[model samples]
Target: MSKRALISVSDKTGIVEFAGELVKLGWEIISTGGTKATLDTAEIPNVSVDDVTGFPEMMDGRVKTLHPLVHGALLGRRDLATHMEAMREHDIQPIDLVIVNLYPFKETLLAGGSYEEMIEKIDIGGPSMLRSAAKNHAFVTVLTDPTDYAQVLSELTENGETLFETRQQLAAKVFRLTASYDALIADYLGKEIHVTDPERTTLTYDVNQRLRYGENEHQAAVFYQTALPTSYSIAQSKQLNGKALSFNNIRDADAAIKIARDFTDAPTVVALKHMNPCGIGTAETIEQAWDYAFEADPVSIFGGIIVLNREVDAATAEKMHKIFLEIIIAPSYSDEALEILTMKKKNLRLLQLDFSQAEVSKKEMEYTGVLGGLLVQNQDVIVETPAEWTVATKTQPTATQFEALKFAWKAVKFVKSNGILVSNEHQTLGVGPGQTNRVGSVKLALEAAFDKPSALTENAVLASDAFFPFADNIDEIAKSGVKAIVQPGGSVRDQEVIDACDKYGIAMVFTGVRHFRH
Candidate 1:
């Protein structure tokens, strides 16, 4: 008896060649709808699925492949005597191979598809046949990706049959694809129908690129893109020039871009190292912002990533080329700027992205993979303003001091836990991040400011990502000549912290909001 292979796909990249090879190997082909027409057009011998079932397709082609003949052929166990007897009694031949791929639900959602259009795009029969075949992997070979065609054909040519291990691996891929496809559809419908929690939670990521290594050299890593579409994310960035991004490079780039987005009112610059902001500055002109930001930590900005909210000009590019940098990202670049920067170093990664539409999508749930399971929660996107703040100290901040306080509040969010940020009116003076204790972070930041006399520590204001535990942090800030502070004020010793601020004659404001990044 000649073996049979079911051929059905929405993506027809390599189907013709794949089917041709199978035909040359003496395998009977069964196809449905557009797939049948395609095989006929290519002059390949095939049996229409309608011919196998002896029934015309109904429900506008939706009912073509859902009949018992299709599923039974795929689900029948070749090793079971009873299953063989049942198949023989019904005159049904086993489907030895199943080639299937689902419809593009994700693509449709991104294309502004109508509700009705998207409803039609959700594939029913494709996933059904894939699951049936994958469930019976001991006897059937399944394929979902076009790239697997060559390997499958090669294996068949060598052994005259697909290997059991190959069948098992292909079966696993089918379930993965179908699960993600169903998850995408449910997420879309949940939004349309206003369902808070679907029956199951699903997140799918596609491998964007393979990195040389992870945070360390011995570990291997790869970058995967989430299903949601956003042009402002690092995945969508266009690399104008430079070496491929590594794990650390991508992490730093993401931190830099987020900080740059915080200061969209004017031209801003953020220089980051090891996932922490070393220098941040906002000014009327990008040139002045870069100068002030670089001056904030001239020693640490070496080989760091720099991001700006505006385009890069020739003068800025010339100054940037003087220093060793890992990456530079902006909205766009002047032709003269590109010519100068590209001419300076071939390994400098230059990226162009637009943050204008990043806020269009609502904040989605965030997840972290643990050793046993995943920890999921809503993203912390709560925004507050000075109008929603309280002046904890008797002395209110001056207008200039208030503006600098607001600037520091935004910049501090990007810093790691136990983080402290110091900034004068124009630029950041020092930043201490990832400390074990709040007082330790305060001391580090103060010492960083006084390291360079030009930092003007006496006139700077401090912002804390979280509330201070004791008055010790206040003592450290006052010793550095910082006269103002901003922090979330819900603490067991809030009065102690407030009394210390009053004792030092420092003005303080309680934002009633905390940002803790771990």
Candidate 2:
């Protein structure tokens, strides 16, 4: 009997040419339903799978390729006498190759398909055949990706058979494809029924890019993104100009975007370094916002990532061009602004994201990897309102001080744990993030606030990520000119801290919510 190859695919990319090449190589082709019709229309010689199985496709073509004949042809060991005898007894012709790509489940889910539509798009026979061929890779060749078609054909034409190593690699790819396919189905079904934590969890992501290094020059890294594009995400942003983003660039850009997204009420600019916000400013105009952010910390803004909630105008671009920024991300850019920024800076990455779709989806989750386990949690996208807070001090914040406190509260949420932020009404005066102790962070923030040529600490508000364990934090704040403060207010010594605030005539608010970014 002639060597037979099975071809079933939903993604018809390069399928006709591949099948025609196989036909020219004197190989028999077995196909089902749409694949057979496609090959027949292309005038490619092929045999229907129904003929091989001697059974008509039933139940809307779902039961076509799930027969023993297909499995025996794929799984039979050609080198074993017993296997060969069993195949002969059952009149099963060995299938030398399997080319199958699963149904469009991911695409359908992204397209907002209904539950019934998603269920119908899940491929059953395709995975079964691919797994059968992959498990018996010693005797069968399997292909799921279309990019492998040319190489597989070249090897078949030259060597008349795929190399053992090639077969093993292709088999591995098949298993990965099937596993990802099933994971998508499982995740979708789980979400449909509101199953937050299933007994078994599976996740999948597609490779976005391979970076030169991770956080350091000695480590390797690759970027992976979800199958569907996420709105207001750094991974979803389009690079308009400059060199490809590195690992550090991506991390800082993500931090900057997240911080910028929190201030949608006004034109906002966030300057980030080492995954922390160095300076954040909001104003009536984007240019003014840029000026406030740059003035917040001119020294730290150098070589940092900048994310803006508004379009980049020519004025803002000119000011941003003066600094050596690693990246500048905005919703859009004027023609002259893009020209001015791209002319002198060829290595500075320019990213454009759509801020219109900045709303957080309910299905979004965050994942972090540890030494031997993974931590999964809902994304911290919540923005608390001032109505849910309580005054904890005798002094009350004035109108301007209240707005400044609100800004500081939102800005501090993006900072690392033990975070302290000193700010006026519209700009961040200083930021101290990731300190070991609360008092240490307070001193760092106060020092940065007062170190400037024109100190920005007069009537500034302070925001801490978590509660102060001791009154020493308030004492440190008292040394500075900060007048108002915001914190979670959950420590056992909360009264002592409040008393320290009252001693200094500082107005404090308890949000009853903690924003720890560890």
Candidate 3:
């Protein structure tokens, strides 16, 4: 006549103590193979599934809880005479409370698991049992997640019966946990490496925060995720020691992180202001990269966010401390490095890095705000190559200038369309980025270029994300006196642009690849 409880969990985080509490509360515990073994080791008495259902587990413990006895107990309403009669006729004891957490399917896929391991990790009976209990909430109480263990126990001790509101909240948690879990399985099966279903996006991420406000401070904002595992996305970031990142902070941090990755081997540094690079440099050492990047435009770098592809050492931190930088992102920091950085400014946000794997196992769906609803697309391209290009002008660029032009081209891809990047040998001099017209952008790019008259020869090379729509780009760019250019030449007047480049004695290469990151 005592109340019975079912407990099974893949993440046995707080199980022993939880079982012990149930023992003190006089609840008869029913469990599967591993859960029962764990409870017995903790000296917690439990009834195994075989003993309770009188049926042995089959299919490597998969068929244990799918039996009629388990569902009958969870679904039966003690207040209903017909349910009680059926329970008595079937000799099934009703289960009062169910605590079940599914297998770590999310973690399994994240840890480079094989197909066999993933198939085994997909939970079956656990979610079914939890959902059954949740639906019959008027008669039964269900719990998922070890985080809820202490709170549930406290409520039971505070009052014998759990509050209706608490039951409702726990039911909601059950659904959300299952939904996120299901989303992971679906997205993994259908997405990731390549889309098995292009128009088959079934996952919808729920917001973790309804932001204080959105871009321009007038629109409403919320953030969500597809629950992908181990991707270097904002969803998995743990802000251990800083103020809440504003909408702008997260956006800029993402941009800076990708930019830093462009120069993988070199100690690259990118200083971002308003989601665009204010200064960028690559050097032999992170310390040197930080120094050159800051020197690229010391005035513009003030209050900008700096990202590094390499680790930040004490020397680099020491140099960064002298400025009013808002944030510093890097792969990692040594103890000495953290000590030095913390001393300069206690609140300067220092973010750890995410070294990219070849293919991320997770893919985020697209969503854009419109007048009536949301417009959606996948995240923009991050990979681009300049392998197939043509030399379109008379005087070709030197190999050194070619390399710099390629670097400049890659940097331009992350900027808005019609972006113009001004770079010398080692660093960006000025960036006239995210403009409406290509000519206007080129002019703005040359604004900070007058500083180094020595590098502004008629031989300096230029790179555009895409081709010049008209020969005017070639004419204006020639005025800056840069004589070489690299672009994806597919415009209608491409030959005219080529003629203009030749007339100005400029060398141009068509990469045959276009990267527009709007």
**Candidate 3 local accuracy as lDDT?**
0.77
The superposed Cα distance between candidate 3 and the true structure at residue 502, in angstroms, equals 2.6
Tens digits of per-residue lDDT, candidate 3, 288-344, equal 888768876788899898888777888888888888888887767888888887773
Off by over 4 Å in 3: 42-45, 77-85, 191-195, 203-228, 231-244, 313-315, 334-337, 354-387, 451-453, 456-459
lDDT of 3 at 389: 64
- For TM-score, the strongest prediction is 2
TM-score of each prediction: 0.95, 0.98, 0.86
- Order of candidate numbers by lDDT, starting with the best: 2, 1, 3
Candidate 2: tens digits of C-alpha lDDT, residues 186-268 = 98888788999788878888898999899899999999888777877878899999999999898888778778877899899
Superposed Cα deviation of residue 222, candidate 2 (Å) = 0.7
TM-score for predicted model 2 compared with the true structure: 0.98
**Candidate 1 segments exceeding 4 Å error:** 196-200, 454-458
